[model samples]
Target: MTPPTGRPLPFPSGASPLPIPSPPALPPHPPLPPGAGGPGARGPGGAGSTGPAPGWRGLPARLARRLNRVPLRARLAALTAAAVALAVAACAVAAWFIVRDQLNERLDESLATYDISPRQLQNQLTACSGGVEVPSPPSPVTVQIVTAEGDSCVGANMIPVRVTDSDLTVAAEGPRAELGPYTPEPGEFRQGTSADGTETMRVLVRPLGGGGALLIAQSTASMEAALDNLVRLLALAAGAGAGVAAVLGLLVARGALAPVHRLTGAIEYLTRTGDLRTRVPVEGDDEVARLSRSFNAMTTALDASRARERDLVADAGHELRTPLTSLRANVDLLLRSERTGRTLPTEQRVRLLDQVKEQLVEMSTLVGDLLELSRPEGERHSTPVKVVPLHSTVEQAVRRARLRGSGITIDTDLGHWYVRSDPAMLERAVLNLLDNAVKFSPPGGRVEVRLRHGELTVRDHGIGIDPADAPHVFERFWRSPSARGLPGSGLGLSIVAQVVRDAGGTVALAPADDGGGGTVATVRLPGWATGGDADAATATGATGVSGAPGLPRATGVPGVLGVPGVPGGERDRRVPDGPVTPIRAVTPARPPQPARRPGPADGRGEGTGDGAAEEPPRS
Candidate 1:
């Protein structure tokens, strides 16, 4: 399920036809139940019994709520339309109000024209001494004015419309002869809406000389009709604009999210192939651009991981084939001897079996080491780094080294120093170094292995790596020319380097210090970074990007002897010839990581069986 986006709804509908949100409920005010003053009187959940409370609950309610997660594009389209609609409505309303007010002002001016300008009204009031300046009198307006209750008043024809009265009250006060009813100011604009429709009339009333009022307003029916028509036209225009805006918003949404669709397709392709070589075209700078950048980074990382995996498997297969071939050959030879006419004596058979057993043991150990390295780094034995006595670990490894090569003599000076390392891995690292030293030393040659100030040096008295071979000396499957006749996988030194480096140590191979006779492998482990005590530390993920062709392709030939095609997998093929030449062969190193601290987020899992049986090489 996708996570939630915390955005407020603009025009929510709680089952309303218009889709406008209902007004917010007024918050509760403090009061209490009748006859209650304490907490116990409160309703359950601290709510008071009043109108039906609102909220969602149960299945139907939740499903209704889920309508809220509609794709953002669609939601945004809806919101845009809503905003445009509101804007247009507001504009139409404002235009109608402005036009209506303008029409009203014009109608008022017409009425005033009929009644009198200050000068005309003044002339007429004083016109009693002049002739009829307004001959035959002007048309009537809604003339109204305040008057003395029983005073006489008049309009133009003859000073005779009774005392002036309010325009609204005049007809109701009495017949056309009543003295007075309503109060109407003479100079003020007299305006009134008609009873039946928007039709109206106006008349001017001016008292010749009396306590009365004068008022006037004209029939404004045409102006009212014009304003109504204008309002309807404005509404139509506003609606048209809203429709156009909606269509444009939809088009914009579709265009803006086009890259998102491309991104989705790219991710699907990579997911299927486990390849990250494809580049997402960089576009204009925006949030989407940043997303593209992040995706590109992820793909690059995956691609690198895939390449490393391919290399690891190829290298591993190259390394494992030798020991396995030797083991198979040695076993077959023992069985063949048994099949011969002479029944092997127990002593001889025992010797052959013993050799088989020893080889088997070595194979088992190598397989175990391979498995350790191949498992996800999460599974690698982890221990907090702490101070550990270096002398004990060196002494133990040296002892094992001496036992591994009965014909090689070793010399060593064990010295005390502290280091931060997992004891078991450190010991294994030291052992691998010593074993490599013995292999390089000629039979009966003296090999020197010493430990001092946390640095262990293993020098041999045999042919060393050529200068040209030094660069890849520590890489997986890399065997040197001088070691062509050796009997071992070229994995020993590589494992040593990884272990040492992982423990914050360094390993390098160079000409020996004394007379520069053989390769001297030196491991410099970090002194303890903390004061905690050291304890025994005990020590592969997604599929390979592509296969390394585990089995050789069929040539379509029927029978081929001594040419069995072996599946290609991970193993170093170039076998180390005696123990002297130290060929470093590694398992795949991890891919680069971000600023992220290590975690189990990689979906790593444990493996079964000797992970070393990853298939052997055919070449």
Candidate 2:
């Protein structure tokens, strides 16, 4: 059954109830007005108003910003003066309070010790009752008597003290007998003004014998005058102390910041003049001195970098002049020929065109070398490094060298060495080395390349480099007098050195150990014997020269492969199309071997071999 509200009633116990549907969902409330529930909106407690922070809350921040505008030295001095003034003020206040308490205690003791004869008290009492004036007391104190009904009597010519309720209470109490000579009757000590209110006084009230109280007061004008003078003196002293402290603080700040001032001046000089040679003078080994040293070091490095840049520009210009001049001259000749309408002979024309082409190629090679060298050392290694098989890179370089120097023979024995480097850059470095060796070799001379134990050496049986020129061979655009006529920009070895260094290696050129009049360029790179793919390839000896097509095989001998005067041509012995083995460490000299005659299969008379090995011409 439904209730009066039109809702269903509960089901009976132990019976299942029918399902009731949910009420329909209500629509969302409308968006709030512009300022409602926003920054300045009033919440229930009115807490969310967008107003400036209270003065006390933001006082420190405002003060700090204002203080920051002041010079550091002035601020420090002012702080010192303020601190001194506060301390002086504190000490002066303490001294004043102590002196005031001591003076008040003495005055209270004198009032307590004061006593009057009974006759004089009765005379004053009779004078009050009879309405007659009483004579003034002998001391500089004011005396009065008060009854329980708050009536008071004062001495003639003396100001009467205003009686408080405490004095009336004392009067209502019956007077007690004196305790002892040293201990006077108890009384309340308080500060009060005279009845006319013109003078401040210290008042003491004590009970009289007959249901009344006696009051004694002393003027505090002298004590107060002394205290005022002390205050003036303390104020003057504090001012003087603050002035001294400010001066001392300023002097200290100036002395401490002297080095900083010098450093700033040096920096300004450098900035204004654009000179990197300026250095700050260093004295002690303090932090400022260390900063000066660091500044000097920075300038020194900048100067060195500037010098290097200047040298590079000068050298580049010098190197570019030769090829540019030749190009200009060749173009001028072609233009003249075209303008004259004179057709040159085919052979001459072809030779001129070929020379022009060669010059262009040389110029392109030089530019590429410059670009490669211009890249920053860090930028060169920014890419992910790959583990390259050093032997394979060397094999590729050898094949290219053979094609370039077809007349010269190149024999190689490369071991399975793997190094982490940019594969293309590594190949370029190796190619440059091989090309250098090929270029310096005689027309029929052999270039021996050996790689083992992470060291690669390329030896050419040509004019050897002099000991003096050895140091400069790797320098940019530096060529020896003997090799200056050769076709090169003199940046080959420099590029090789830079690349090898980037790969954590070293390259050097020296006279061959055999003293056979040749130069051997040795490159020692740090790498592993086998890694990743090279590990598998090395397992089966797949990295040998025989597995690499287009690469000539190396003769197994340690020194120059061919015998000096063998019947069979040395060319056949230098490079045989057979399986090659790893070369042993190169020694200083080769052991003599028995000379043998040419066999039928040797093809000595059949002219199959190139030619016999001739001794290298001595310098």
Candidate 3:
């Protein structure tokens, strides 16, 4: 059932036929008319009518691809060698021409000086009449006389030059006034072959008396041999120069590309080994140096990111284990009781269930915090930044703290302050700070929360932090040694720090001043002086038109928390067990000082001026 060439096999009746395989077909072109092909006429699809259309449009692309196949070092070396060879060749040609012109000028001057008087020639002719042979005038010089009758004379033992029409014309015309043909000039010369045709001569003609001319011929064989020797020497020198230039070019290219090779090797090693700590060495401040610096910076960033990820995973696992273990234990206890067929007492059973529920809630909170902190700085919940009232935010946080800390008295002193930040995140940060204060406060103790301008401070009247443990409070999953028994995942302060930083502010912790027996957590955020509507309002002065709702009119007192009844001379409405500490009405203090930077007395998150995260302890 095999198919024939270029055809499909026949199928039986009611049987499916197999499809034949073929190469892709090009679009059909219109038929070309015979004998219409001519210049500027296009074929089908605008292609040429030649045997096969040329691919000139892709010529540059093809050349680029071919060039890319060559090693960069070899290309650089070859190019340098070619440039040097061109320059050297140009200089060699110029030198050869200069030498040739100088030699020709010297030879012409020497030939012009060789002249013989008619008397000397007559004496030589008379002596030779006795059959006495005379030697030639000189080895390469021939003396000949040309007369008006187109005849020639030669020195003894020298062949006479065959007279030509040029010689007869020169003799008839006499010497030219402008140093024409028969006139001998310093630089004028002519070249002709001797009658014997065995040698070429450079002839100079000098006129004699009675329409006669003397032709002195000098052989040019020696001059031509010298020029040929010079040409050979120049070619040798040029070749040697080209070879030396190639060697030097190769050496220079290698030296120049050494750093690039090192960089390539380092990057390859890093890729193969999955190592982020590798760095390329930098030497000079050139372009390569800048590239090296950038590469080092990239690797450093990768290493830091990897370390952060590792820390997050480890901390998350550690925090999750406790709650999970508690849940499992409680579940096992209930299962055992059921298996034994013993009905546990109602109170004990209720306690076990409650414990399980608490563990579940704790685990859920831990997971949420982990997810929140895992995102990079820009990816926190996409809460839009807006002008928010800081005073109202603090008041709201205080109310929440009051609910959480039942026995503790919370005091608040806030001045009208506004800031541009994500209101939701800012409130969360404030709540965390207040909750932290309430948590650490002793039963029936007072917690002071104050905000003026953009600075906010939360102080608790509990056991303050030890000097040794104050440095790890804001680190992920870091718990104080004394507070390990507390029910916290140790992520609250970390969240607070991150939120404040995202809002372009800083947070720091220190022991309360004047031996106060508690820690003070201060957050400084950049803010507008007024409630964002009135820019002219001072810190102590209140502008009530656009303030947060449900607040009493600000009284004459400066720096007082504008809560109801507290201002306008009313008694404190809601008092707890501790002393009624009146919220300080701060007099117009020098425009709220800029955020205090961390120094020897301050415990910052990252322990640096830039306020990166640090491992400070929490109380």
Among these predictions, the greatest lDDT belongs to 2
Candidate 3 per-residue lDDT, tens place, 14-91, comes to 222222212222346898776456555566534455543476667889988998998788788777777777887888
Query: Which has the better TM-score: candidate 1, or candidate 3?
Result: 3
Question: What TM-score do all the candidates reach, one by one?
Answer: 0.57, 0.63, 0.65
Give me the overall lDDT of model 1. Answer: 0.52
- Relative to the true structure, how large is the alpha-carbon lDDT of every model? 0.52, 0.65, 0.62
Lowest lDDT 10-mer window, candidate 1? 536-545
Off by over 4 Å in 3: 1-67, 119-134, 141-220, 284-286, 335-341, 376-382, 406-409, 439-446, 460-475, 478-487, 510-518, 532-619
Q: Model 3 Cα displacement at 129 (Å)? A: 13
True-vs-predicted CA distance for residue 131, candidate 3, Å: 11
Give the alpha carbon lDDT tens digit for every residue of 1-619 in model 1.
Answer: 1111222211111211111111122346888657464443544443453433455336576865775778767766767787898998998888888887777666655654543344444333323322344554555343333233332212343212222235324423423322233343444444444323235543444332323334444566677778778877877877787778778888888889877867877888878876679767769889887898899998898888888788878866765666668778878877787687566788977887776676676577666666756766444434333345778777776776677678898888876655545666667667767766666566798888776544677777665544455556665545654454445555566667766655544577655434545666667553421223122111011111011111111122111111112357321122121211212322222222222111232210101011122221111
Clashes of 3: 10
| Candidate 1 ranges with C-alpha deviation above 4 Å | 1-74, 94-191, 195-211, 219-230, 270-279, 303-341, 345-351, 375-387, 402-415, 437-487, 501-522, 528-619
| Top of the candidates by TM-score | 3
Model 2 clash pairs are none
What's the number of clashes in each of the models? 54, 0, 10
**Model 2 lDDT per residue over 398-480, tens place:** 88778878899999898887765677767777777777777766678899998876778888876665555556677666766
Candidates sorted by TM-score, best first:
3, 2, 1
